[model samples]
Target: MTLKELLSPVKALKTLSFATESLILTWKEIASLFGLNQDIYTNPLHKPLAKPVTAILIGAGHRGNIYADYAFIRPDEVKMVGIADPNAVRNGRFARKHDLPAENRFYNWEDVFKREKFADAVIIATPDNLHFEPCIKALEMGYDVLLEKPAAPTEEQCRIILETAKRTGRIVSVCHVLRYSPYFRQLKQILEAKTIGEIISVQHLEPIEYVHMTHSYVRGNWRNSKTTSPIILAKSCHDTDILRWLINEPAQHVQCFGGLSWFKAANAPEGSTERCIDGCAVEGECPFSALQIYYRDKKRLYVFDLPDDTRKWNKIILRNLKKTNYGKCVYRMDNDQPDHLTVNMQFDKNITASFSMEAFTSYEGRCTRIMGTKGDIVGNMETYTVTDFKTGRETSWSLKTDYHGGGDHRLMQDWVQAVGHQNAQILSSTIDVSVESHLMAFAAEKSRLNKTIEPVILGV
Candidate 1:
């Protein structure tokens, strides 16, 4: 497809134009021609109404890989116009894998936005602190954005990004990929039906609380708060967003307390080296082995996969464990962001929710208890358990999600659909929806420091 045609889904299809009426039949025929009938022709949602888009990916680090996979293969709706990351080596590899033309590959996001003149969209998957600059600039440059979560490091930064999004009239979607999950969507609808009868309060416990946090924030590059934002913002933004979604409450005041308790310098074994492989011992005994485990080959990758999964990380690690150091020694790295954290949020619904985030737990998953005046609902999202207090009955269901709660595929398809019809999902609306969760995260730091509750709204 031509570059301009690649920007708009409705205009990109070579065969089907607006005047054409037999789209389903045309799709079936086209799908049969490529032997992709099963993959493409089955759903009205899957077919591209127009031309596919060409997206420029920024910060091809860990999360960048996920955004790239969805943009390129899963959606089959966006061309990978290019990729830009400060680490040329890393993004360069991505370019090579995607077969992007050399000119399409860039060393910095600014160069791509400034020099290249344009792209249909930009996926800002950089570090938390580095997000605002590229996001604002790219929106102004006319590229719709799909930003990684914890939209910005601070409240002001979050506002800046949101303001620019409005002025530009371009889209900006946060990587709060959970909102797209069927599992969660069902839960939201159930709660909205007053399943528990107006949530009076909520208690959320993220065990090792979502394994990725332990992998990335607790023991990975984002381990230190100084390097990024707090552990809450860096890792638990998804969890925070969940609170907002389930409770339908804007966080008012939040109080949190956490510290680098378990994975500290004092905890390190004397014989162990700063590096993992050169350690004194415990390669087999200790579960947190970095060299023997997590990154023996490549570092941490994204959790979700597209085409029907919330995350592919579990599969990726299991498949490549011997090749990468995924579960090795934890003490060798400069770990810091709190092995545990607790946040108390008072929502506008007048419901108070307490979230407990921990990274050191042996068991990995999420557990939440929601109490209402008339009844209650207790759920273990990882295990798929739901209990109702009103009926005193329990219902159990598990989502067979391959990646991102099996929602990535649907999410990508819809994004293409949105780009096709200009009907973007409200969840990815890129303004307050993105800003609120992050502001709470930044406020959590202050609350922890002052030993008091910091208001999420601060003012409103």
Candidate 2:
């Protein structure tokens, strides 16, 4: 039976009655009835690797370690052959987890690259500024790369990485994990099925939780654009990518406006100290108080991983609280990234999109609204409601998993499979495909800085 015919009966019901009945059709059932639940798009036929696809990891930091841990989960699919990082503790932890010998663990990428290439691929999860060189070098060494996002901190560097990938005929996949997410994948399927008819516009918001902003951007590694990249490129390039992917068009121009408004010295409470560890009168009331976020919450201890011994952990955390940036009062920090940002984009085919990222939100997740000629979609990362304009009937789907909406692990699996088969085509966020989003982010930043509409210059 045709999908349209199958849905005809449901559509014929009154809107009020259909809403209740539609709840009976699970997302899977709706997809299946519409012939959209099959895995035909995801299941690419390729020759499996003769042996597990081995990889060398650069930067054993948070992101790097997360990707490395995937090997521990599915060792038969991919193997961690080498690791390089400056931090002894982080480097040792990953190396030990992967059972790497001393010979395979180096203190820096320079030292690791001095040896003859031994791994099939290199996973470059280094910082924003460090991405380009290692990626180009890895490709030159005849290794495919799974690079973390922003590609690089600049458009020129992004171009170089893409050019080098082409020159060396190597695969370079960017970590646009959202593309591999089930929620987003299903959304794409529904859109392609014309349930949304012709999409006219989209509005997307990324709520950067208040505490998260204080942790990552206010007092953390990505605090300054001069050292890293703009907030838009560092944080919200994934959103730009998602918007473009949903619209299925290249962005022609972008305009943006934002600045560091809340997390400045001017916004500090009366008698507030530079560090939260100090006896500040308002520490009890401050939402961005480092003490409450890092010390009070044990789950948040991942960022400050101390020894498991209670006494040692407490002592170390207290000592570090007085010394590290993590304990700094968010308002007194030297952070330059915007606490809020808004962007508008015009894409090919007259499709328009607007995006907002705010740091003062109660929750962390993306909320999106897509308006089409025949229907509309509205949802957060967890669930979405699709309503057909003509029938006024709605269908809803809820996603159970919340780890980047199940994108994180799925992206790792897809990358492993692609590398194992020497087939980059299996990846949804290949460097060539993802670099356009990077360019769009660059243009957005340019627009914000110059107060003018900036044209997107795509390299691929």
Off by over 4 Å in 1: 1-48, 71-76, 86-93, 209-215, 279-284, 295-333, 385-390, 400-405, 423-429, 458-460
lDDT of each prediction vs. the true structure? 0.66, 0.84
Weakest 10 consecutive residues of candidate 2 by summed lDDT: 10-19
Give the TM-score comparing model 1 with the true structure, all chains together.
0.77
Please identify model 2 stretches exceeding 4 Å from their true place: 1-25, 401-405
Please give the lDDT score at residue 205 for candidate 2: 97
Error of 1 at 396 (Å): 2.3
- Highest-TM-score candidate: 2
| Clashes per model (N, Cα, C within 3 A) | 33, 0
State the lDDT at 293 in candidate 2: 82
lDDT of 2 by residue, 370-408 (tens): 999999999897888888777666777777632234466
Residues 1-460 of candidate 1 have per-residue lDDT tens digits of 6778655443443234223432322322322322332232124434455677767888887667766776556545777778888775676678887888888888887788767555678888887778889888888777777788778877787888878877777777777777666456655755776655778898998876324554676555577788777778877888888888788878888899877776666777766654555544655555566543344433344421112352654455545443333343455456667877888888896889899887756576577777877666555764333344544444343444312344555555555555555545433334567677878777787898889978776332
lDDT of 2: 0.84
Candidate 1 lDDT: 0.66
